[model samples]
Target: MQEVLDALEAPPIDPEARIALQRYYVRCEMLRKVDKRYSEDGRSRITLLVRTIIESEGNENALVEPVLVAVNSVLRPGWTGKGLAFIEAFDGFPFVTTLETMRGLNLFKEENLGQYLGMVLHNRLLSLLGPPEALSAEKPKRKPARPLRRAA
Candidate 1:
């Protein structure tokens, strides 16, 4: 795990993105340490999800990692996290970070890491897209829904 922590130093990524990534790592650790109540056939849910993420690559029938997809959309669009290391894509475009400072960070205490990561990712997307006013201006007006006809 030290190696994973140390890996954060070489390629700088966004602070928020870094936090999300670390939180994910911490989550994986937590899942690893949790009891077997969550296990099925000797494998925990996290293990299954990680397997899916790895095995699903290039196969249309396999389940994709939705969280990874969202992370890529905000950090580096169209990136598949292929060839590059697990966290390398964060160094591109808008996302970039150090984990040393995480020791004192209170936000990590949240119970739901996934929700927290989503919030961070959303904020990063908003920042990159521009201010809220600009976003509102850019949004196209939606046409009103037409009434549906009764089959009878």
Candidate 2:
């Protein structure tokens, strides 16, 4: 939403941090695209994996192990290898957006993780496709001044 975009554009943060955050946002959006293509059961399993990852609180090893298990157990047959590959490729860092999304959905109170995941995924997709001009903080353009008229 505009709120998130505005937050990204807010001043005073370290420029490196801002860039990193934007990159993470893009990565999550990419993951969301992959996630959205899953079948219903696969999506449910992915939601569970996301919950597990969030609960892991950035513990890389803790997140990876159980996710591997879930990938093998919950994903569609023969997709386990692909799922594992996806995890390996994308799960390098704990995404702040994922945590915020989990909190926003109140994952603890929700029985249906799939719906929440869908909401987050859709938001990310929208962000990815949002106004390209708004992606960065650019200084406002000043109109050119008219040539000074000669005194009549």
lDDT assessment of candidate 1: 0.37
What TM-score does prediction 2 earn? 0.24
For candidate 2, the 10 contiguous residues with the lowest summed lDDT are 63-72
lDDT (CA) for every model shown?
0.37, 0.40
Error in Å for residue 24 of model 2: 31
Model 1 lDDT per residue over 86-130, tens place: 233233322112121322465554333434454565565455443
Model 2: per-residue lDDT, tens digit, 24-135?
Answer: 4455566667876433442344343443333333533333222233222333333233444433423443444544466686644333433444444334433433321232
Regions of candidate 1 where Cα sits further than 4 Å from its true position: 1-10, 37-152
Kindly report which residue pairs in candidate 2 clash with one another: none
lDDT of residue 84 for candidate 1: 44
